[model samples]
Structures are given as C-alpha cells and as structure tokens.
Target chain A: MTQSAGLVAEAILPTFTEAVELHKSMVFSIAWHFLRDRSRAEELSQDVFLELHRRWGSLRSAEHLVFWLRKVTGNRAIDMIRSRKVRPETSLDAAAEPTTLEQMHDSLLASYLERMVATLPEKQRLAIVMRYQEDLEPDEIARILGMNVSTVKTNIARALSLLQAKTVGRLQPNTARRLNEMPGETGK
Target chain B: MTPFEQELKRALARQQPSADFTERLFARIEEEQAAAPVRWWQRIAQWPAQTIWALAPVCVLILLTSGTMLYTQHRRAVQGEHAKQQLLLALRITSNKLQATQRQVNEVESERQPNQKDNIRRLL
Candidate 1:
C-alpha cells in the first residue's frame, strides 16, 4: 500500500488485546446474566469488544467508551432474550442437585440475585444489573440506557419490588437473618 | 435507596472480571493503532506538509482566476473613462443647442452662486 495507508494500518494494529480485556467482564456479565450460558456469554462479550475495536475513535474518553460497551451489550442481550422467549431458561446446574437450603449464604445470595435479575423485564433487568453488578449510579445507568435518571431509578425500584415480593415468604429465616446481618448494615 | 440495595451492591461488587481486563483492552487499542504502516519518521515528516500539499493546487487555481478577474476589471474601468470622455467631447461639439444649453446652465449656476459664496466665506 501507499505510505499513508501503511501509516494508517500501523496506527491501528497495536491495541487489540487491551480493548478485549477491558470490556470482557462487563460484556460477559451482561450476556451471562441474560442468557445464563457461560459459553454464549463469552462469545457475545468478545463480539461486543470486537465492535468496540472497530469504532474506538468515535468514543470520547475511557469512561464514555465503557458506557458505549455497556449500552451495546445490554441491547444485544435483550435481543437474545426476546429471540429465545419460546425456549427454556438455561440452567447452570443441570447435572448437579438442586440448591439446598443449607448452601444458601452471601455467595449464594449473589447467585440467586443474578438469576432473579435475569427474570425481570428487559429494561428493568438491565438497569438493575448495571446498578448492582456494575455499581453504576442511576445517572450513569440513564446515560448508558439513553433513558432519564428518574426512569432508571424507577426501573430499579420496580425490579427490587418484584424481587422482594417473589422472595418474601420463600426466603428461609436464615437467609433473611444473613441479609439483615450483612456487613455495613448502617440501619438507617 | 435502602439497606437492601446497599447490601445488593456489596454482594455484586465481587463480580469483577479476571485481573487482566484493562491491560487487555489497552493492548488491543495499541495493537489497532499500531497496525498502520506509517513509520514514525514518515508521520513526523508528513504531518505539516500534508495539509499544504493537499491545498496547494486549489490555492494556485484561485490565484490564477483572481488575477484574470482583476485584469478584466481594469480593462472595464479604462473603457468606462473613455466612454465618459467621448460623451463630453460630443457635448462640446454640439453647436446647434450650445447657446440655449449655456443659457440654462448659467441660470442654474446663478441660483447656486450665493450658497457656494457663503460656504467659501465661512471656510476662509
């Protein structure tokens, strides 16, 4: 190629792997929570980063780039969810025994919460996952989802209400006790 | 918004990816940026010169066209002065109406003579 084209090509070849790793977790979590399939999650996550690679210059800053990745990954996950509406939710424990009451704890709570989050409506599910899993503020979630901050807060509130209603009587006393005793319970 | 949300935050905070994620992302960006074959020396050489090169032909064309336009304008201005001189000469040679024309001109000049004399007296 011409010298200019060569220059362009050289400029683009150096940062492939770093972009892949930076977005791997967020992308993978979004996909995994929506699909409940690790392999699918990994594949989708890689696809999301590959896309980010293609459009890296359009992103303004590191934080802006992360927001773009989260938005794209969330939209792709919702598309996957709707496409598979007729099929069953993929269970990670197909070969293992069902979760027993004895195994319920903080770690189990995270897992349960992940599964329960997957069961929410697309917007609510994504907003809650971003808020909780990514520790993003409501305004950040709004920016990522292209929604208003109030809308993001409402989605999170609704998702929590649904989770609270569903698990109100189902949670064992021990699980409730553990939740109450969870570290940093500043008890306001 | 509540203790439960705060607890949920604590629980979910543990889901970070394997430690190498940022390094991987930066590496990928570097790789992509590096793919272009323009050597560093070539980039340094071309940066300032490229814009000048791209605009050079257009600049030359504009200058050429403007020179041509100015020449035409100069020619038109000369032609306009020549026309005015011809008109004046024709007016001077028109003997048939010269007397009547000079009589009317003298009357108009007489009417404005007081104003011109007053202005000159003020300036002096």
Candidate 2:
C-alpha cells in the first residue's frame, strides 16, 4: 500500500509542474493583453500560477487545466478592474512596439487594424484580443469571461465595427484596397 | 459575426509573447519548488487573519455602543445623587425653622401664665 501511494504521488508531481509550464504562454498572454502592460501581466500571471499550484489536486485533466487557467485569468482581470480605484490609460489596438513583426515587410494592414482595436471598451477589447490576438473562438471567449454566448457575440460585433470604422480613413488607398481584398472584409 | 470579425482574428494572431517566456517560467517554478514547504500554520493563517479582520469592526462597534451606554448611565446616576443631596439639605433647613417656631411658642406660654396667676390672686 505504501509503495503504491508513493508511486502515485511521484507520478502526479511532474504532471503538475508540466501543466504550469505548458499553459504559461497562454496564461501570461491573457493577463498581459487584458492589463496592456508587461510587468503587471507578469505579476498577475505569477499569481495565477501560484493559485494553480495550490489547487493542483482538484484539476482532473489537461482540458480542465486550460479551462481553469483561462477562466481564472479572465476573472482576475475583471476583479482587478472592479477593485482598482484608478485605471491606467491603455491603447488596446496599438501595434507591439518595434518587434520583429513590426520590422517584417509583411502585414502592415494588420498592424493598422491592431491600432484600431485598441480604442474599444475594455470588455470588447478583451474579447477581440482573446479571439484574434490569442486565436480563441467566440465560445471559448465566453467561457473565459463567464458570459453567455450572445453577449460574447455582441462584444465581438461591436469591436469589429469599431475596428472597421477606424480603419476606413486611416489606411492609404492601396493598403485599404488590400485590406478589403481579404475574404472577411465585406459583408456576405 | 460578419467577415470583418474573421479578418480581425487573422490580424491579431500574429502577435506573440517574447521568446524567453517558457524559460523564465520554468526557472521561477523550480526556484519556488526547491524552497521549503510552507508551514501548516502559514497555509492556514488566512482563515484566522480574515476572522480577525471581520471581527475587528464588530468589536469596535460593541465597544463604542457599550461605552456610550455606560457613560449615559453614569451621568444619570450622578444627576440623581446631586438632586437627592439638595432635597436632604432643603428638608434639614425646613426642620430647623419649625423647631425654632415651636421654641418661641413655648416661651410666650410661660410669660402669659405668670400674668394670669397674679390677676387671680388679687381678685381672691
């Protein structure tokens, strides 16, 4: 009995550590995107990981691990929003500063689109950031934010409208044409 | 729900975190694990801390309420004691006046008795 118990404990220990490492990117990205600052995101992400360590026993599977992390990140962001007496200025759609992507020749239109997304309301901003920036689906965004499917849809809709409107006058004629050439640029 | 939504997703997915994220996270995690297991008391201290936090306001409220009640009662008792003393002093003064009036009446009666006795002897 003792041998079996020890084996089980040893087996579970590595898995817990592996789980934290595996989801760190997704967790950190969510926090950073919501907070719009790297340092705060890092701190928040560390808090989430610590919480995950504390609750390791209750999580049953890999899928549950991702679900819990995403959900907690969203809830924590919202809690941060509610609890804070002062809100710092954040530009959601702003392109990441001077990264390889910005230096690359391709996707200038996409960069413009990001700047437009930054002006959206916090909820809409988070939804769009998670959906597009993190490649999360609407349903997944709903799960993370603890909102119903329709509300998530509304947030996405409002975000896209804002992006489209902002992009119309900002992009040059050729870049605008290129953006419109994209498949989802126009209504069906 | 429109096509623009899809394009927005395509645009945003290109952004990624700095490459060193995984390496940093592992280093932090290992450092934490190598450290000592938190004492059981530390693990459980939040409950007691929260209990004390929650109880602090109630304790303050009870102290304030009891203090106010005791102060009011003390004031009322002092006032009652002061009124009783004044009433006793007033009664003492009234009793002394009454005693003085009685002594004067006794003196008058003695003087009137002597005058009446002389008149009666002369008439006999």
Q: On residues A120-177, what C-alpha lDDT tens digit does candidate 1 reach at each position? A: 7789878877877676778988988899988888888777776654543345776665
Locate the minimum summed-lDDT window of 10 residues in model 1 chain B. Answer: B41-50
DockQ category of candidate 1 = incorrect
Worst 10 residues of 2 chain B by lDDT: B41-50
Which stretch of 10 consecutive residues in model 1 chain A shows the poorest summed lDDT?
A: A1-10
Interface RMSD of each: 8.8, 8.2
Instruction: Output the lDDT of residue A5, model 2.
Output: 19
Query: B68 in model 1: Cα distance from truth in Å?
Result: 13
DockQ for each numbered candidate: 0.10, 0.10
**Chain B TM (all candidates):** 0.38, 0.56
